[model samples]
Target: MEFIYTNPIGLTDLEVLEVGTQACTPTMKFGPGVRDMYILHYIHSGHGTYSAKGSSVSVVPGGLFLVVPDTVHSYWADPDEPWHYTWFGFVGTMAARLCKQAGFTGSPPVRNPDPSVPVDPLFSEVLSLREEPAKELLLTGLLYRILGTLTVPDDIPPLQPDVGLHVRRAVSFINARYADPIALADIAAHVGLDPKYVCRLFQQRLSMSPYRYLTDVRMRKACRLLRSQLPGIAEIARSVGYADPLLFSRMFKRTIGLSPSAYREKAKLENTPSGT
Candidate 1:
């Protein structure tokens, strides 16, 4: 059975365009055409061949194939054993980021996760929700869950070397909210860990406490602002989480070995044209 959504409008960061399942007959084929959105296929049974960029690859049960936007591709069920597959197409602001996180970068355009955990059930669930009132929202969540099965952003700790999941979340929280009045407790709450344990994780993995790390991130951002010399000292200070220019100056001197004005002057001199 095959189905397509009537309106396919993108409602949130991610949206499902259409979804369907089909069991191919012998030698069944489609495409060698291009699509404007991303379509992912999960093979449920049997085998087939997928071709893209002048290369062809055999896909079997428990395999996945991706069709990225504007990429010409073709797939055909095996002449003797044809395949049954479920697929969904999606387009969204977060689609590219999620696709990259899922390791779907087109070169091979295939993923063969552990065959023990099949993904057909998740795809089937998408079809099951076609008639619901909250169809779009439900489909979006299911899409994220489907992608979650493939991979997650912090699976390999891309932000820092040797950082565990909790620490990574803490760091991400700090990086995003350093300018706010957030505290270590907030970071711990975000990651669902004890504040003391979060501190311990940071000290062991990052050589600093969570609060200290937050300060470091703030000071680094302050340095960039000071170098630009655009915002006033008080504004710069507040932008980096300091409400008082005096306190920000003191912290800047302590962390950077120079006052904000001094640093800005130095940056100005260094950036001055040679002959001007």
Candidate 2:
């Protein structure tokens, strides 16, 4: 069956498509499509069979399935059962690399609800966003959270030189100095490694390049600044380590699809008291 609706959230790098219905009376078919960086499906209700890479798996309520991009996959619900599911498809350079680092390699899909562990709350949130904007952001956040949960399993074997420690240090440094003009070299220097090696380690641990991750941090900070009434455009840019207001505005618009002024204005309007 053709997808009746698709909602994309965030920037081009990351997107979430929430699918509604699940029953396929006649066998449904999907041609080869790009394997997204990440495809996360939360089965809200009903049952279905999803096939990918010549392997098929039965899906049920509370089931969570993740498929990496470029893998051929399709699904059909039992005519009688009719599956109701919410699927989030996201592709980002970092997201893709992270999936691999998390050991979600190859075409075989990863099933979360394996008849043993309890379903995670993240699953519920993904299924709840059926509408627009909220659906999109929620799905994006869910994918991020899912990746976080999956990548750092408790039982994973230890890494040589304790890669996690270097990653953790890098993350800490970024968080503390995000407002500063930080670079990958600085992060690598903090961990006493060459920049190239640090980049590889970050990709292995975080599934994204340090530059993108730094940008993400700055953008998140920029959003907070937009919501606040104090910071001017130039000040906000400086706060996020961009010295040029025009350059910052361009990056902001590219990442957020709205000029900083417009974003702040909308945010103000939404928060303003009705009587005032």
Candidate 3:
């Protein structure tokens, strides 16, 4: 079963686009092709070979292989013991950086999880979240947790004293509460800073005012929901914190350069697979 999720919202760090499990038929293959996003497949059972950069790696149960964006690669199930696996596709500004941090940054990018790590439950939870609505936040958190386990604590550099700690906190606040009737003062209060100081920090760190950042977060989520085509305009508006559908339409078009319905149609066309 496979489900696609475009609800990125305020998850600027990483955005999960799709997740699924598949039991490959004998010798089934894909690629010598490229993808626009990163895909990570965990081999649950059976065998396969993943080839890239002129190298091939044999993958077995509990192994993981990563397909990097825009890189040509190919994989096929073993003719005798075909593989079953769970996979997720994702993309974001920070995706590649995080992938490196998780030790996934090389040719034929396949590796077995550390013996002490428990990864099955994390992937299982991702599959479960596929069946739920409004799972963007949960999915992002889960992905971070899963990647964290794959990383060596000693290899990770210790954090420096963050001068922008308040800015980061304020952004987290907006990410968690964008659907509510929130304002700059509320964000400032959450970060224990004065409203004007918060505004200055946002401008210095993010190059935008607090309200502009909030609108951007709301508009991004609105775009995703529109593309999904699963909710009415009014419902999508409310989900992104707008009480009035008309106002939401105006803001969406202003920020995204198309009405919600128009954007949906365009996304559908673009997302349609090559043939069917």
Highest TM-score model number:
3
Better TM-score candidate (2, 3): 3
Model 2: per-residue Cα lDDT over 21-126, one tens digit each: 3434444534444343366666767777777788777878877666665456776776677766656555543555556545455455655454444445665554
Among these predicted structures, which one has the highest lDDT?
3
Question: Can you write out model 3's per-residue Cα lDDT over 176-197, one digit (the tens) per residue?
Answer: 8889999988998999988998
Name every residue pair that clashes in candidate 2: 22-83, 35-69, 35-70, 36-69, 94-208, 98-207
> What ordering of candidates by TM-score runs from best to worst?
3, 1, 2
**Per-candidate TM vs. native?**
0.53, 0.50, 0.58
- Candidate 3's TM-score: 0.58
Give all candidates' CA lDDT scores: 0.77, 0.66, 0.79
Q: Worst 10-residue stretch by lDDT in candidate 2?
A: 1-10
Lowest-lDDT window of 10 residues in candidate 3?
154-163
Per-candidate clashes, comma-separated: 0, 6, 0
